[model samples]
Target: MSELVAAEDVLLFVNAAVTATGQREFRSSAEEQRFSLGFLHEYVRVNYRPVYAAALALDVNHHNAALIVEGLLRTAGEAGGAEEKRAEGRLIAARLAMLPPQRVYRLFRALRAAGVNNRRTRAIVRGWLAARPDPALDAVKYRTGVKAAVRHVHGRPADPETGDFLFAPGRRVRYGNALLDAYRRAHYEQSAVYELPFTVAEGFAAKHGVPRAVFLERIAPRMTRLERLRTERASGAGAELAVMPLTRLALYVLALPFGERVGRRAELTGALRASARRAAGPYAGSWGRVTAVLDDSFSSSGSAVKRRRPLAVALGCHFLLEALAAPGAYTALWTSGGDDPLMVRPYGPTPLGTRILDALETEPERLVIVSDGWDNAPPGLAGEVLRVWRSRLDPGRGTSVVHLNPVYDADGFDVRRLAASVPTAGMRDAEDLAALVEIAQFAEGRTGFTELRAYLDRRVEHFLTEAGA
Candidate 1:
C-alpha cells in the first residue's frame, strides 16, 4: 500500500474505534454497528498492531478501550514480538485502571465466557482484584461477575464469609463486614437496604414493598453522582450540574422542558461554561478566530437507544469551543438558524451547507463543523463550498476546516465525511475535541504516520505516568 493509503487505513480504524460503541445511531442499527466495529478491530489489529495498541492511549471511549484490552489478551500469541507484547501489556494495564469498576468487572466476565485462561490473563485479573479498596463490597454489589471472575482465575477471597456469600450464599449465618451484613439482613429489613449502593438497594426495596419515592429519599446519601442526578430530576430537586460531565450536562439540558430551560437559562449556561473550562484546562483560550457550525436538525435527535445524543454532543462542543477559543473570537452558527443554544431542539432538516457558507463568510482562522455530514439541504453544497474555498478562494489554505462527526456510518465503515478536501474525525465526547482535532489535522496533507506515532508516544507516556503502572 502507498504511504497515504496506509495512513488512511489507520485513520479509518481510529474514527471507528473513537465513536462506534455497538449502540444504535440516528441512521444505523445496533447489530450493524457491532458487526462493522468488530470487523475493524480485527482488521486493524492484524494489519497495524502497533497502531492498534497505541489507540488504547488515545481518547477512545471506555467501551472500545475495553474491547481492545480483551482482544489483545484473547489473542496473546499473535503479537509481533516480545517487545510489542510488553508495550501492549503496559497499555492494557493503564487503560484498565482508567475504566470504571463495573466495566472492568464486565470485561472479566467476558474473558471468563471466552475461556481465555492464559497465565498472563490470570495475573492481570489477580492484580486488579488485589488493588480493590474493598472486595467485600464488590461481592455484595457485583456478585455474579465477581464470583465468575474469581472462580475463573481461581482467586481466593480475602474474607471467608465473602466466599460463602458468593459461591455458597446463606451458607454462613452472619458476616463481620457491615456491607455484607447489610446484604444478608436486607433480605428482610428495608432499613438495611439504604446502606447498599442505589442499584443493589433497589432490589431489596422492591422485595420489602418499599415505595420508590421513599426509598430514593432515604438512600440519598448512598446514591452515586449520576444516580442522584436522575432521581433528583424526577423529584424536582436541583441536579448537581457542578460535578457532571459536559456531555451529560448537555443531555440533561436537552431533557428539560423548553420553558424550564428558558426560565433557568443563566444557571444552565453558567454550569455548561464552567464545566467546559474544566475540560479545556490548559487548552483554554488557545484556538483563535474559532467558528463552529453546529447541527441540531431532526436527524441529530439520534435514536431510540441514544435519545438526542448527537444534539447533546453538538451542544457540548459549542461550550467547549467557547472555552477553548480566544475571548470574543468564537461564533456559533446553528444549522436550524437558532441563536439560543439553550433552546435548540431537534427540529428542521439539516442545512449544513448553508451553515458552512455562512461560517466561511466570517473569515475564521479555524472552522469546526459538528455534523453527521448528510448536508442535504441543497445536497452537496457543503462539499462544493469547501472545494472552492480550498482550491479557488484560498489556494494557500489560510483557514483550517475540520469536521467532527458524532455518528458512525456503518454502511461506509467510517464516519461520513463532508468532503475529501476537509479532514474528518469521529468524536465520542466534546471533552476530547482538542485531541480529536489534532488527529484530524494529521489526516490532512500536513502530517502523516511519523507525526501520529510521536503524538501517540507522547500520549502513552502521559497515560502511563498518570496511571502509575
Candidate 2:
C-alpha cells in the first residue's frame, strides 16, 4: 500500500480500537460493531502487522487489547515476521500487565480452548501470574479464572493450599494461607464470607440471604476506590464522587434525576471542574483562544449499555477544555445551544454545520469539535462548512481545527469525519484529549506511515519503562 493509504489505514484501526467496545451504540447495534471490528483487526494484522502490534502501548481499550494478545499468540509470528517475535512478546506482556486481571485470565482460557499451547504463550502467562502481589488472594477471589489459568498453564500452584483449593477443594482440614482458609470456611460458615474480598463475598451474601445494604455497609472498608464509587449510588453513601474519572463522573452526574442534579448543581459541577483541573495537570491553561463545539444532541444519548456515554465524553471534554484554555480565552458552544453545562441534555437533531459556522465566526486559534459526526440537521452541512472554511475561508491556515469523535461509526471503518480537512481522532475519554491532539497530526496528512510507526515505537518504549515491565 502507498504510504498515505497505509497511514490512513493504521489510523482507522487505531480509532476503532480506541473507541469501539463491541457494545450497542446510539446509532449502531452490538453485532454491527463486532463485525466491523473483526474485519479491521484481521485487515490491520495482515497488512500493517508491526503497527497493529504496536497499538498495545497506545491505550487501546481492554476488549481490543485482549483480542490483540490472542491474535499475536495464536499466530506466534516469531522472528521471521515484520516485527520480531521478541519485541512483539514484550508488547504482549506489557499490555497484559496493563489489562484487568479478569480479561487476562479470560484471554488465557480462550488461548487454551483454541489449542494454542506455544512455548511463548505459556511463558507470558506464567510471567503474569508470577507478578501478582497476592496470588493466594487471587486463588480465593478469582477462583474459577485463576483455576483455569493455572490448569491451562499446566503447573502446580506455589502454595500447596492454593493448589489444593483449586484442584482438590476441602482436601485439607485447615489451610495454611489465611485467605485460602477463608474461602473454604465461607463455603460453610456465614461469618467467614465477610473475611473474603467484596466480590468473593457477594455470592456468599446472596446464598445466605443477606440484604444488599447490609453487605455493602460491611464491605465498605474492604472495597476499592472504584468499587465504592460504583456501589455508592445504590448504597446511598461512601464515594467521594469527585474521585471518579471525569467521563465517569460526568455520566454519574447525568444519571442523577434532573431535580436532584439541579438542587445539587454547585456540588456536582464543582466536583467536575476540580477533577477536570486535575486531569488537565501541567497542561492547564495552555491552549490560547480555544473554542469547543460540543455535541449534546439527541443521538448522543448513546445506547442502553453505554447510556449517555457520548454525551458524557462531550461533557468531560468541555470541562477539560475549559481548564486547558488561557484565562478567559475559552468558549464552548453545545450543538443544542445550552449555555449551562450543568443543564445540558440530549435533545434536538444535531445541527453541527450551523455550530461549525458559529464557531468559525469567532476565529479561534484552536477549534476542537467533540461529536459523533452525524451532521444530519441539514444533511452534510457540517462537512460542507468545514470543507469551505478549510479551502476558502482559512486557506492560509490561520485557525487550527481538530475533531475528537466519541463514537465510532462501524460502516465507515473509522470514527466518522466531519470533513477530510479537519483531522478527526477517536476519543473515549477527554482525559486523553491533550495526547490525542498531538497524535492527530498523523491523521492530518502532514506525515507518512514511517513517522507514524516511529511514533508508535516511542510510545512502546515509554510504555514498557513506565510499566516497569
Candidate 3:
C-alpha cells in the first residue's frame, strides 16, 4: 500500500470511527501507526485540528479523540450535531463498559464534563460497578462528589433538574451555569472551539437522544431559531415589545372611513381598532390619543378619507408589534411569525428613538437616524411627515438621517420596484419600509442572508483557489 493517504481518505476513516463501524484497533505495526497518525493529523489540520489538539493533550486515546473531534464539528460547523453527539456518547459508554470500577469513575468525570448524564450513559457506568459490587460505598462516593461539585458555587447543573446534582439526590450541581459561561467565553474568543461542540452535544444528546447525522439534517435549523430566541430573551428584547412611534401614522389612517363600499368596512375597522386596543396596554397610558384618531375617522363623510383605511388597517397591525419590538424582535403574531411564507421583522431606527433626541443634542456627531423609506402611510402623506420629522431631528445636534429606500418584504406590497419605476421622493408605501429596514440592518454591521451568501462565496473561492494552488 502507498504510504501517502489523502485528507479525504483520512476523513473517511475518522468518520467511520465516529459512527462505531471502523477498525477499532489502530495499526498494530509502528510504521502503520505512524502513517495513520500523520494522516489523522493532516485531516484535522484542514477540518478540526484545534479541537483534536486540545482533546489529545488531555488524553491521547482514540476514544477521547473521536469525542473531541465531533464536539468541535458540532460547535464550529454544525451548531447542534445531535446525532454525532449520541454516537460519541455510545463510544464513551462502550469504553466505560470495558474498564474496571475505578477506571470507570474517571470516564464518568470526563463524560459529565461533556454534559452526558443520561440514564443510558449512567447504566454503562453502573455496569462497571456491577462487576465489583460495592453496594454500601457506591452511593456515598457518588453523593459526596456531587455535593462537593454543586456546593462549589461554581457548579451549575447541565440538566434541567436545577439545584440537584447528577450523581446523588439532594446533592445539587451548578456545572450547567458554569458551562454556559465557559461556552460564551470560548465561542467569542475562539480559543476552546472543540470543547463547546463536545459539551453542547453531550448536554443536548443526554436529554434528546438525537443521532449525529439526524441532528445535522433535522434539528439544526430549529436549533438555530431557538438559539436566536434565547439570545434575544437573555438580552431582554422579548419583554420589551412595544409599538413604534412611526406606526401611529397607520393607526391614524385605519380609524377613518373611506370608499362607498360600506359592506366589510365596519368589520375591518373593528378588527383594526381591537388590535390597537390590545397593543395599548404595553405603553402605560400612551394608547388613549392614538385610538381617538381611529374613532373620529368613522364619523367623517369624505370618500377620500375612507379610501386610506384598508392600507391603514393592514399597516396598523404591522406597526404596533414591530415598532414596540424595534431594532429586531419583529414577528407578525407569535404563532404566525413561526410559520407560512416565514415573516421576520427587519431592523429599525438606530440608537433608539427614546434616546435619539436627547443624545443628538448632547453628542450631535455620534447620532445616526435610520429609516426605511416605506411606512404604511399614503404616498404623499408618508413623505411629507417623514421630511417634517427629519427637520425636527435637530441638524444643529449634528444628527444625520439616512433615508434608505427600495424596501422589500417577500410577503409585502412592492414599494421598491415601484420606486424604481417612479423614484419619487415623497411618502413611501409599506413595501418601501420593509426593504429599508432590511437594508439598514445590513448596513449597520448586522449580517443578513445576503451577508451569509457573501461569506459562502468567499469560502467557495478560497477552496477553489487552494485546490488549484
Candidate 4:
C-alpha cells in the first residue's frame, strides 16, 4: 500500500516537475532532486517505464536518465515473446518521442552503449535525427504519431489530412484553414466525445446555442453526478434537473444549488439511507460498534467551481460505514449542526475535537473520521483529545482511529497535526470507501511495499489481458 502511495506520489511529482511553472513553491529543488534520485533508484531497479520517462524529462541528471535507458534495454532483452518485444519497443518509442533533442541524443547514446540494436530502436533514432529542430513541427508530428497509435489500438478511423485519429475531443487540426472548419463542425454536430474538458464543452455549447436541456442530456451523462450538479449550478440551469440521473442521489443532493435543496432534502436523506442499507447488507453479522465523524466545514465544500466534492466523498464514506455497522452499533456525527437527515452541507468551521469527543461517548471500537485534514475550531485539539481518551478510558481495548483525507495537501503531508498512532489514508474517489479494511491496514503500517507491488503487477496483467495483447 505504501509502495502504491509512493508510486502515486512519484507520478504527481513527475507531473509537477515536467510542467512546473517556476513561481510555485510546493517543494524546493533540493528536496525534489533528493527524492527523485531515491525514487529513480527504486523504480529503475524494477524497470518502471513511467520513471524512465520522468527521469529523461527531468534532464538535470544525465547519468540518471542513462541509467533509466539501460534499465529499459535490460527489460526489453528479458522479454520473451514477439508481442512483448513489440510492446516494449512501443513504450520506449513513446517515451523517447516526448523528450527534447538533447535528451533523445542522450538516450540514443545509452542505447548504443547497451548494444540495443533492434530494428524498431534504430527506426526511432533515425526518425529523431531526420526531424527538423522546429519545436512546433516536432510537437505536431509527435501528437500525430500518438494519435495514429491510439487509432490502431482502438480500431478507430484515421483523419484524412493528417492520417491520425482524433483521440481527444478538443484536439485542433493543423492543416490549412482546417482548424476553424473542424471547430465549427464540432460545435454544431457535437461529434466530439463528451469527455472533453468543461471549458471546451461550455464554449462549444455557447457557440452552437445549445439549450440547457440539450447540453445536460448530451454531456451530463458523461460527467459524475457531482460534476453535472456543479455545471448546472454554475450555468443557472436548474430547470435541467428533470433530465439529471438520480443514481448517486446522496452526492447529487450535496452538490445541488442552495435554492433547489429545500424540496429534495427529504428525498435525499431517504436515498442515502437506502444506499447505506444496500452497501451494509453483506456484512450484517460482522459489524461492531462504529462511530464516524464527517467534516462538513467550509473547506470540504472545495472551491466555488468544484463545490461539495469533499462533502460528497465524506457522505459516501458515512453511508458505507452506516450500512456496515449493526443497527444499534453505529453513530454518525457531522462537524456542523444536523439532526435526523444528515445533509453533508459545508458551511461553518471545523470542530473536529468536539465531534470526536461526542462520538467517543458511544464507546465505539472503531472510529473513522473523514475530512480534508484542515481542522480549525479549537485548533489542534483533536489529537490531544484522542490521546487523553485512549490513555484515560480504554488503553487496553485497542480502539482504531482512521483519518481519511479527500484533499491532497500541497505541503506533502497527509494530515496537519494528528496523533502519530492514528493512520491517515487518502480518499481520491468515493469508491475508495469500499476498501476501508485495506486503507486501515495502510494507515497502521501493516500493508507494505511488497503488497503494493503485487497489487500493481496484478493490475498490469489485467490491463494486458483486457487489451488482448
Best by lDDT: 1
lDDT of 2 by residue, 9-119 (tens): 999999999899999898889999999999999899888777888999996789999998898888875335544788888889888888888888889999999999888
What is the alpha-carbon lDDT for the whole of candidate 4?
0.56
RMSD (Cα, Å) of candidate 3?
Answer: 23.4
After superposition, candidate 4 runs with Cα above 4 Å error: 1-251, 274-285, 340-342, 415-417, 446-469
Candidate 1 versus truth, CA RMSD in Å, comes to: 1.4
Clashes of 1: 0
Better of 1 and 2 by lDDT: 1
Candidate 3: what lDDT?
Answer: 0.33
Instruction: Please tell me which model should have the higher TM-score, number 1 or number 2.
Output: 1
Q: What TM-score would each prediction reach against the true structure?
A: 0.97, 0.97, 0.20, 0.56
Query: Residue 225 CA error for candidate 1 (Å)?
Result: 1.1
Q: Give the TM-score of candidate 4.
A: 0.56
Q: Count the backbone clashes (under 3 Å) in each candidate.
A: 0, 0, 23, 0
The top-ranked prediction according to TM-score is 1
lDDT of each: 0.89, 0.89, 0.33, 0.56
